[model samples]
Target: MVEQNFTKVKEFILLGFTADLQLQRVLFLIFLIIYVFCLLGNITMIFLICADSRLHTPMYFFIGNLSFLYLWYSSLFAPKILMICITDDKSISFAGCLAQFFFAAGLDLSECYLLAAMAYDCYVAITNALLYSQAMPLRLCASLVAASYFGGFLNSTIMISKTFTLSFCDNNVIDDFFCDLPLLVKLACDVKENYQAVVCFIMASNVFTPTILILASYLFIIAAILNICSIQGHLKVFSTCGSHLTAVTLYYGSILFIYSRSSSSYALEWDKVVSVFYTVVTSVLNPLLYSLRNKDVKDALKKMLDRAKVS
Candidate 1:
């Protein structure tokens, strides 16, 4: 019975941006460049954090996992997008597309919780500076990261199982670049309240839960900052958290607009454009936000570069 479900569609055709040869070639080059840059930025951040003893902290630890997630997250869709651009072949087998989405979703979802965890780390580091080390102990940090991955795993599992169980009785051509959930849901022959319930639950788990936690943590951090007498203290607090705040705004804002609503309300064109930021551009921005913005990371990277020059 399960085999029948799996065999219902041997493959799916992805109706990507366009079919024009000239445009396709242009897009290929564009995506290739972005992919290369994103990989370089993320990999460099990971290299810097790992190589430098100074970065061996809970904050850098989470950032390392985030860089790894960024690498895989972009890899899931960027390669497919570039391949379609180069070959103009958008056909992907059921297992291949599902696998791509599953892993990608896991990483994306993990990033959300991970960001929230990072925010909590910031709050502790700033608001509770005296006990920051003890409060967010090494063991606790590792556990939080593990929990983020587990949460993402559950999210991806529910989404994939629920979505694929739907009857794709007709056309299998997904009208977007990648196997997006809303776009895929639109292909279903039937959608019930149960489906919406599942989606809402998934949204709450991945989006609202994390957003609320981040906001709550920041609220306390803000209170802590407001209590400071000197302006320098305020600036310090904001500098410590500004990059994370920017990243949270970018990621959660777009996602809330796109996924928090019902699937029936999805605007395919708008969704496609918005998804590019979180799916592709975020991978590029994360390293910059989490690492490049930090003085420590910049100094470490410069030192490494000069050492390489000498060696």
Candidate 2:
């Protein structure tokens, strides 16, 4: 069958957060500062993990991956946002939009699985203290990390493929700050049903599936915490998982709120605000949450500082 004659839209115009000049300028400054801090923080985590011998464990390995993911995640959108703020040009090429969507979705999905895996790692360590090392062996840890990246990359490919298959005609204005899948689907002129179904499938697999896994892991973790005979033991377990739980709650909660509904019902303004939480705020908070609340990471940083002083 010949391809449907669809008007090829070469570029998309991003409406951005606001049309108000004052508000846009204020937001630009705030986000620019946040972007800088997020980048530096995640990069610092990666560097600490790589340099510290004491942090050469499965847990730290995953932490490093999360850091690297955040770096890419922030990089995927920050530059474009910065450009949009500085210039009057708000149009993005069709290819550029697809590229942004691909990397952003990939990293976001990877973070979902990686966060769940990290929670599971904590569960194992807390619940099976005696065999934590043996159970989360280096090879197994490596496999899990590899699977997280592989899973993320695979999901991104599927979503992007589905998106590209859709025919875009006429409408090229996206009512969003970035090239989100749902917004893109809304812009398509024909075969909206098929595109919607494809988007729903991807959302279910990428968002809901990982959320279920993380919730189940936390359930077991909570049960294990309750079974602890001593208050001290319970506190210890809670302390260990608290940061991970906080990060998980913020990330998954925002995601669930966003993708767990129909596109027609989506509140664009509210959605953009919430999107900032996961995309930008989360990146900034992850390192602080992990480093400040995590004993191992704190110790590693101290040791690294000491080494630097001695040298």
lDDT of 1: 0.84
**Predicted structure 2: lDDT:** 0.83
Number of backbone collisions per candidate? 0, 0
Candidate 1 per-residue C-alpha lDDT over 176-213 given as tens digits, one digit per residue, 9 for 90 to 100: 77887777777767767898798768867677788889
Those runs of model 1 whose alpha carbons end farther than 4 Å from true positions after fitting are: 1-7, 260-267
Candidate 1, 247: how far from true, in Å?
0.9
In candidate 1 the C-alpha lDDT for residue 255 amounts to: 82
* Model 2 Cα lDDT, one tens digit per residue, 1-311: 97663648989998888787787788889889999999889998999999888888777888888888888888888777777776788999989998999988888878878887898898898889888889899898878878888898898998888787778888898877789877887777765576668767776777777778778888888898778899999888877788888888898789878877688966467888887778878889989988998888889888878888999
Give all candidates' CA lDDT scores: 0.84, 0.83
TM per candidate comes to 0.93, 0.93
Q: In model 2, which range of ten residues has the least summed lDDT?
A: 190-199
Pick the lDDT winner.
1
Which candidate comes out best when scored by TM-score? 1
